[model samples]
Target: MNRRLLLLVPLVSALSFAAVTRVEITERGDVLQGAAFGPAGAYERVAGKVYFAVDPKLAPNRIIADIDLAPRNAEGKVEFSADLYMLRPREAAKGNGTALVEISNRGGKGLLGMFDLAAGSSDPRAPADFGDDFLLEQGFTLVWIGWEFDVPPGPRLMHLYAPVATDNGKPITGLVRSEWEGDKRVTTISLGDRNQVAYPLADPNAPENRMYVRDTVAGERRTIARDKWTFSDATHVTMESGFEPGKIYEVVYQAKDPVLAGLGPAAVRDLASYLKFGGAETPLSDEQKTTKRALAFGVSQSGRFLRTFLYDGFNQDEKNRRVFDGVWAHVAGAGRGSFNARFAQPSRDGHPFLNVAYPVDLAPFTDDDGLLKKAAQANVVPKIFYSNGSYEYWGRSASLIHTTQDGKQDAAIARDTRIYFFAGSQHGNGSIPPRSVEAQNQASVNDYRDSMRALLVAMQAWLKDGTEPPTSEYPRIGKDQLVAASALAFPKLADLHLPRIKREAYRLDFSVEPPRVGAAFPTLVPQVDLDGNETSGIKMPEIAVPLASNTGWNLRSKTIGAPDELYSMVGSWIPFPVNRTERENRRDPRMSIEERYKSKRDYLELITAAAQKLVSRGLLLDRDVAKLRDRAAKEWEYALKLN
Candidate 1:
């Protein structure tokens, strides 16, 4: 009974494992799609034959199949057959190709074997070498296992070669490998760690390193070429050329540095400093020194490599002038005349009238004197020089405008350089003069606005296409236009009574006192009309209108029903001096006591509750207008009581 049972068991087992198994592989987009046997008992019924189909859309010309088996399975014990067809096409057979089959024990313990298929005939290939001797011959140290290929321009044949260990011996996988589309053959042997692998693309023949350097200060530039031999240690030495003696030059360099093998720590530090401070002589703190030193090193190296002169220390006045000379010479040598356009004006008459309203108070916003010189050398010419009304305002109110001479250093600018003054306007407020008393009164505001617009238009035409402007129609009383005459009108320039400071002097020794309250106002009040006719008229104080309602006194308008002889009193009562003579003489406290008392009385009446409400709305705040009115009253009373 036992013998019979054993025979039946063998038969049953063979029959169970003999049935065919079906496998499917599908690919979608860049992701792989497929299914495998489950870990449970689902795959226990698998047999010797397997079949898989490829998605027709995949356009796959080859298929790779991996097979896994149990350890008890002997070598060559399992045989398999496969048939492939396109499901969508519904075709039985479209083409024929070779198939490669490899076999190994479940744990990879058995000898590796392969079979090559062609024309329906199966033939065994040699065993794999496992050492991959074919890759070694190609100067590749096999660090990993993978393959890369470049498709040829046209269809060609090529083979993937590798070695595998076999029980009998080692054999090359290329014995059965084949493919179409031949291109340049380049084999890359990957190492065990991908990071350790070196690719042929990094070879020097691929692309040589090259860069350019620009010396902005010296206005020079150069290009550098690099190759393997050129970049070797002591190979990539940087050098400067085309430098003129006695001329300061600005140099800049740029290059790519490898993290592992590029510039050393010291080189890096020096380069960093050069870029930061541009070689300033001013003493730097420890932190600043370190930073500047590093930047300099970088900039210097880049400048040297690009053959550009160092730009460091070229921003200083003396040094910058030298650099500018060098730069201009280069520009001239290249036959470029309009390379730069900076210039300076000497006196008001030598400058253009249009630029006069820009206000000297704006000078602080401009580049330092050194940079200005460089700009001039480069051909920069100022079209206008604007000054403000008085000294109690911003400092930049005294700028002079000028144009460069045809060809002379530091010569007075041409008459084409305009000079304009903002009458009753202070500092930058001249650009958009206010009509409020807190600013300039309305009539003065209108005059400044109209004049500035006209000047700008003239300048635009001059710069855009060289169109000359007609004589400026500045606001004038008789034949003379209003101008800023003293420190009161242009605070930046010292007062006439004050001593002048030489430009070359390094230190100022004079004591500066704060302007005293009720200090005399500067600037001359016009005494005639535009038509040159002498007129006696009353000057009114600018009035504040009610915010909620427009009805109120228009202080700027002429007042009627007052005695004509009283007009002089109106002019005399002004808080600030009205005429140049009065301005100069009013330093004495007793010149106009009656006028001061009358002005205070009038101011008190003007700042009523109704007036306060109106002014608060316009000024964007709710505050007591009486405060200013009371303050003005006190000042007027004090001036009147002065001996």
Candidate 2:
């Protein structure tokens, strides 16, 4: 065995499980809300008996809802099961009202129901009984509901029920909303779409066509903004909508393209300003401009802030692009009450991060990238930065590391950043991997999971602390070199370039590119038995006396080939101190592994010739090459010495 491999195996075995740990904490609660659209006085309805329960089986204590949905055909035939665990709030000042509902079936199932214990109300109301046909017409299957009363800080109980037929089909999907106190209460909502019926009378895309507004002071429903198109294009739309101290106003959005919806009434005014003075070439109409200005004025008077922004895949169609851009603008603009923009280009050398399974190399050109750049330019560095996978259905494991590195290098960043890489995570968790027999084994999937977790941990540390990260490594070649270290070896920055102005965009400055050079190869002398088979024994090659004096051996390179693969052979020397005055003073590239071995026979012949010449001249002294060769030969003999 190679000497280095012998040294590494024992160390790896010793350190394999050094950092594994197990710990547990109680699971927290999550808030739920009714669908945005429906009838007036609409509240999230629950059926059957729903009670909160704590589970000891799950780690980090889990708080779940035990629901009993009766027999489908018979009334009161109860079916009991626990659906989701509630998460704790990040801050107490923000109130314990905010909650994260663990989506059942990985968010494939819709929310069953929401109970308002704070309202001190147990009365139940169905969508059909309410005097609102709009809820049915608009296909508002689920509504996120919150209460007006203040419940004491601690574990609380509520009840909910799911309609019998709803479970037979696809699961419902929507956002979870949490309410804060005071006239400027903050409302947090999560939004998504799900289909439960095969074909409904209303547009199947009704969820996208509707928007909801709430009166913070009165705690009453305001209005629903309907789009002209059958579907809404925006995804992850976050808007800061509330009233200020002395100003009574509502934020709203209007539908532009039959498919695209504008900001609601409460947000229209500022949205309009964004479309105008925001430097966008495609400005909004005069009406929009006026509305946005008024909203801005109201916001200033009330001492309240609002902003909005959008996120979408850059390569998506125009419809998706608009939706993403609009959502990002709404969220970023509303949250910050101002605009900011930034840019980042994350690329690894040789495109090594772009493996066939996941290609993150193309992300810089996507909508997320563009939106971030725009926000940075506007001086709004968003708290949350969103990015999608480059390949249609693959993990961004490799690309994420490089991108994080690039983000760190970006000069415009003013605050720390957090990156979320979802697990079993293929292209934002929507694309599912085909279930194969091989996938049934947990070990088969461990590597991907471990890699993702490590990446996230590293990212968090980089953001929370000011530490730079070490380059990512991958297993290749041999056990000793299991984790091949990665580095930006190439000096040239062909892939790295600065943005250019209009007409001169095609030009590049070559003077800034780093220089490259040919490398030397190492010598390898294989030890074999009489059968000529390469046995499990190896040794360093003998050094030529004169050559040894000029260039001592590099032990690290001797054991392992050059960490950088630019070089070809092992122990092949290159000319040093080349004359800068001469243009043609370059050395030949090192020989390949195969050629080195092939030339070994000739090398031995030269050594023999040198040895014979020295002996004949009576110059074979203690400093002779023959003696050095003899010593190396002895080392090899001892290395191959068998028991």
Candidate 3:
């Protein structure tokens, strides 16, 4: 192994444009017990902290919300630090010359699970955790740097340690809102999203602190009696009468000392810059520094982070150099999150029935104005892939990214950009043998990760040799593939209720106690075939040759209440009857599984053929065909034995 001495030495350095001041290596260990991955050989895990000091005066730094108000050192540079972790080939020269950085999603690692098909692990140390080592075998260096400040603290989780913003050394106070929908009766809940740290309550007895509850996303808010609930602590609230299931509760309280959260994007930009362009003192040898290009991958909340990052002009470093050569933002829809505003909450995301509404899904839904304007002006526009799933169309107002502002026509895609919709899939990649919990129906089990693997390769090829990838494959208004919810022509299936309601993205005004909601933007969904499968977008083999009706919208189960509301981030899978007799007995409109295929072998063959079409079109890799067929075989068995 060509390990360097920097692992054992403390190093302090400053990049030409970035603010990375020092790197402290706290631990180093062999990955997968020193298992070798193809020609890349053995890999190791490097974990530590990365310290930064940014000059608030720089034009690039000035955009960071409250950076000027943050505490600065003697040199007038604001100081902060973040947790860092990397998985690289032991012999750096043996790896691909590109760094694949996965912005940690809520302080957790997901790249291995998404790309490598590995079981998720916050601290991946076992062989199962590495899975097939697809990423390692490809020789790409994997990197993660904590960029979220409010992520719940666990020993294995990554975190950004940022300084608070103040007004002339005095505490700055503002109204902070936290909201949640109760799944079950509960007396207490934390103020932070998923129990991460919340801003400290400024004045506990402030009469301005108010609580409101509603039954639905658009329902009227009713104030709870002031004597009914009390703040258990700065972080939690308690009610004498337990919060009812299916009700949304929101609290508005005055909080002080907001963190300069916009620095998260700067951290991402700086790390990419530092890796591509080395600093005055460096840990990597010249040969080890073979990473000439950087690619960023972020999913869900982190995906929205990338969109906001680009919109905020963080792609260009202080040196006016492009940070990432390519970026893949998966399942982000057209939304940007609360990533860069005063008193921003990075974890607060907009969803159908989950985080109802915020600054997310705001104006400039298309790329015309707010998204790419700054990047285009700076000429730092990286190749971008806005990949979403079917759920995004129904639950995330994803059509806004491709359609006109009025949803009347298709918007022109940028030359350097591509948009892909994973047909019949959910927000998160689905699982086999679909399970149901909060959703009314069986959850969608359309696995789209195999297709994602193909897209990643295509992205690399596009960057490497200028090879054009498969053209954007999303529903278009001009093609009649996208339609309004009211125009949907769904087949009547027994015991199945089609959801006619859609989540609207309303213009919000947060200047008052309760935000004044304004006119809603038009959002459309993809047209569906007879089987209730999406007609447009990249379809996996299971979607193209299926045994069930896979839909991207699922209603909340009666057990969780609000049965009329769409379950957050969930999709539904309604299996076809096993035979014609069963289909007739159930009064099903769609063809039965047995009617579609003569036998399991026939089903497998059809699955293979469907996969081959995608492989030929560069939407799926050839190696994944066998697995798709295997999964189809299981579906065949599961359908036949259905009671």
- TM-scores for all candidates: the values are 0.20, 0.21, 0.97
What residue runs in model 1 are displaced by over 4 Å at the alpha carbon? 1-372, 380-412, 428-447, 470-643
Question: Which ranges in model 2 have alpha carbons more than 4 Å from their true place?
Answer: 1-86, 89-369, 382-444, 469-643
Q: Write the per-residue lDDT of candidate 1 for residues 450-536, one digit (tens) a residue.
A: 223233334434534556644321223233332222221211111112112100101111121110122111222222222111121
lDDT of 3 by residue, 100-209 (tens): 99988999999999998989998889888888788999888899998999998797798999989999999999999988886899999888887678988998799889
Worst 10 contiguous positions by lDDT, candidate 3: 8-17
User: What does the lDDT come to for candidate 1?
Assistant: 0.20
Writing each residue's lDDT as its tens digit, candidate 2 over 346-371 gives 01101111111111122232224343
Task: Return the lDDT, model 3, position 624.
Answer: 88
lDDT of 2: 0.21
Candidate order (TM-score): 3, 2, 1
Provide the lowest-lDDT 10-residue window in model 2: 340-349
Candidate with best lDDT:
3
Error of 2 at 358 (Å): 20
Candidates sorted by lDDT, best first: 3, 2, 1
